[model samples]
Target: METIIVENIYKYYPAATKKERNKALNGISFTVKNGEIFGLIGPDGAGKTSLFHILTTLLLADGGRATVDGFDVVKDYKQIRKRVGYMPGRFSLYQDLTVEENLQFFATAFETTVEKNLDLIHEIYIQLEPFKKRRAGKLSGGMKQKLALCCALIHKPSVLFLDEPTTGVDPVSRKEFWQMLKSLQLQGITTIVSTPYMDEANLCDRIGLLQNGSLLGIDTPENLTRNFGKPLFALKAEQMYPLLLHMRAYDQTATCYGFGDYHHITFIDPHIQQADIRSYLQGVGFTEPVEIRQIAPGIEDCFMDLLNH
Candidate 1:
């Protein structure tokens, strides 16, 4: 079953003058399947949050239509709110309230109680139990994250919308959070998570790569990377900074960017060999420790490829 459906949606923010309005969403269309974890992947200002607000019925689209669990987003907002959970990009909880207080407040607002939904949030709730009495404002970033998620799920929502849920969270907390989403999927909850981190895109069943309020592509991470249709390589050398500059300056270098410990590159001339890149680096006075070998394209690589051309 399709839990969410969006078609030709468009949204714009009016500027000082009518001629220069900021277009936040342009011809956006996609669907989320029941029990599927779909990811909207892109950098900031890619329309992820805008699209989220429209689907959740907090904002109206200038054009087109959407439905949540088969209800019209515009006319059935009240019903949608009752059945869906939303965690905005920013922490909007009552800072002065204790963690437990915040959870209870949200449950009450949903016409439910935390105790009634404990089974749905047991794993995350247990982690926040120790900090139950702590003021939400005083909790660490990770703790605040957990408390917010617990409150969002207090009503046992059928669909959850998480906007950058892992932002500003520790590595361990981020990993735990994704695992929690996976568990929710097992219970037949549909999840739509948006993140700017390319690495996180791989965790979703499928991802939509958005840029400048437009979707570049949508597919499974493995399939997208495999279909990039290019020979990619990772190059590392003694003077990493200088190596980067020289490699980018190389005539045949199509794309070059620093990625973790190595500089990843793609070739403009498909016929170019690995040995040719090695010799070029050597001639440019690079140290002997220089290494260049073929590597598989990652999501980030594919994103850059899409953005570049």
Candidate 2:
């Protein structure tokens, strides 16, 4: 069963202040399978947050329709809200409230008690028990994040919406958060999480890549990577920026972009031989041309390829 079915969803914002309001989400559509963790992966300003808002019923779409657990977002919003838990990108918990108080407050809103929902949040709440009496604002970033997740799960919702939950947290905390979400999947809760991290796309059962309010592709991480028809390589030199520009200007160099420690390069003419790249770099006066080899296309590589297409 699909926990969520989004069909041609679109939303546009009006101009505010001097800036023109952007098309936050174009006619984007995707399905999140029941009991699975689905990722909406993209960079900042890619409309991941806007889509989350619409699906969670926090905002209505200007076009299309979406349903959460068989309930239409607009027509059955109350029912969907009761069955879905949302954790926004920012930490919006009550700063003055103790960890336990914050948890209780949210649970009460859904007409439940922390004690009654103990089993539902136990996997995450247990991590927060030691500092249950501590103020939410005073807790460490990791701890505060866990508490916020527990509160979202307090009502034992059928589906969970996490909008960039690990954006600013430490790496260890990010790993822990994903583990927690995976654990909840065993309890039959569907999770729809949006992330700016390309690396995290592989963690989900399926991922939808978005850019500039449009969906570029959606597939299981394995399948998406497998379908990348172009061969990729990481090439770098002392003068990186100029080298990239030079490569892009070449007819054989199909695509080039910064990839963390190195720049990723893809060739359009597959038979164009590596010697051609060497000659091109040397011809451009590139000093100490670093290693270049055929590499597997990562999510980031595929994303760049999509943008180029």
Candidate 3:
């Protein structure tokens, strides 16, 4: 069942000059299935947050339509709000309130009680129990994240929207947060999450790559990488930046971008081999050893490829 449907959504913001409007979302469209974890993967200002606001009914789109849990985002916003739980990118909980108080506050606002939906947030709330008395402002980043999530789920919402829930969180906390999302799936809650981290894309059932207010592509992580239709190679040298510049200037180079410890390059000619690149680099000023090897494309590689095209 489709829990969410967004069709040709468009949004615009007034530009600084006031003579032009900046398009925040450009005919974006996608769907989310019941009990599915859908990820909006993109960098900052890529329309992820704007699209989230539209779906959550916090902001209206300039054009097009969207429905959450079969309720129209515009006309039926009240119904949608009741059925969905939203955690904005930033921590919006009361800083002066303790963890317990925040949770109770959200529950009461939803016309529900923490005890009434204890089972819904029990797994997550347990982690925050020790800090129940701690003021939200005094808690750690991870603890604050947990508290926010607990409050969002305290009302037993059928659909959850999390906007960059782990942006400033620690690595350990990020891993734990994804695990908690998986747990929510087992309870039959549909989740829509947005994140700038490419690594987290693999954790979702499927992802939509958005850039410059446009959707680059949408598919499973494995399929996105597998469909990258070019031979890719990772190259490393003693001088990384110089190697990158040299590689980009190479005649056979199709796409060359710096990855973590190495630069990933694709060739215009599929027949080109690693030895050929190594030989070319050696013939140039790169007298030192150059490590070049064929490597599998990852989600970031796929996203970059889409952006380039």
Candidate 4:
């Protein structure tokens, strides 16, 4: 079953004096299968949040249509809200309220007490229970994150939509959070997550790469990297900064993007061998220069290549 189906969805924000609205989603269309972890991978201002708002029934798209769990997002918003659990990209829980208060409020709003959904959120809720008396605003980034999620799950939703849920979370919390998600999936709840982190893309069953309100491609992490169809090499030297400048000078350097610890390069000319580049680096007295070898492309590499293509 398709848990979410969006077709040619277009959302625009019109300037008050202008004749046309700025487009947020450019006729985007995709379907997420039931019981699968689907991802909307993109950077900030990439229309990811806009699309999430549309599907979660918070905003209206100027054109096009979307349905969640067989209910039209526009026409069946009431039902959709009831069946879906949404955690917005930004922290939106009651700031002044204690952790327990926030959870109690949402539980009462849904007319289902926390005890009613205890089985649904036990694993995550227990972690938050320790800080139940703490003000939501006073909690750490990750604890607040867990509380927000617990509230969302109190209703035992059929589908979960999390927008950048781990954005400011600590590494330990992020790992713990993903584990909670995996546990939720075991209960048959479909999960849709949106993130700007390329590393997180691999955790999903499939990911749609979005940029500037456009989806560049959709595939599993391994498949996306495997089909990159370009040779990539990693180069390192004592004078790393200067080495990149020299490498870029070569006409054969198709793409050269820094990857923190090292820089990745792509060859436009197949005839330019790795050994030739190695010898050139040596001639510049680049020390042992470590090593340069053909390397497998990762999610980030594929994303960059897709943008260029």
- Backbone atom clashes (below 3 Å) for every candidate: 0, 0, 0, 0
User: Pick by TM-score: which candidate is best?
Assistant: 3
Steric clash pairs (candidate 4)? none
Off by more than 4 A, model 1: 16-19
Higher-ranked by lDDT: 1 or 4: 1
Alpha-carbon runs more than 4 Å astray in model 3 = none
Q: Model 3, 263: alpha-carbon shift in Å?
A: 1.5
Clashing residue pairs for model 1: none
Model 2: per-residue Cα lDDT over 210-275, one tens digit each: 999999999999889899986778876777778778888877877778887788887777776678
**Residue lDDT tens for model 4, 29-99:** 99999999999999888899999999999999988999999999999999999999999988999999999
Q: What lDDT is obtained when candidate 2 is compared to the true structure? A: 0.88
Weakest 10 consecutive residues of candidate 4 by summed lDDT: 282-291
* Worst 10 contiguous positions by lDDT, candidate 2: 284-293
- TM-score for all models, in order of appearance: 0.96, 0.93, 0.97, 0.94
Instruction: Return whichever of 1 and 3 wins on TM-score.
Output: 3
Q: Write the per-residue lDDT of candidate 3 for residues 7-38, one digit (tens) a residue.
A: 99999999989788899999999999999999
lDDT digits (tens) for residues 1-309 of candidate 1 = 899999999999876787788888889999988889999998888999999999999999999999999999999999999999999999999999999899999999999988999999999888889889989999999888888888888998889999999987777888988998888889888999999888899999989999988999889899999989989989887788999999999999999999999999988887788889888878988756778788899999999999997
Q: Candidate 4 has what TM-score?
A: 0.94
Q: Which one wins on lDDT?
A: 3
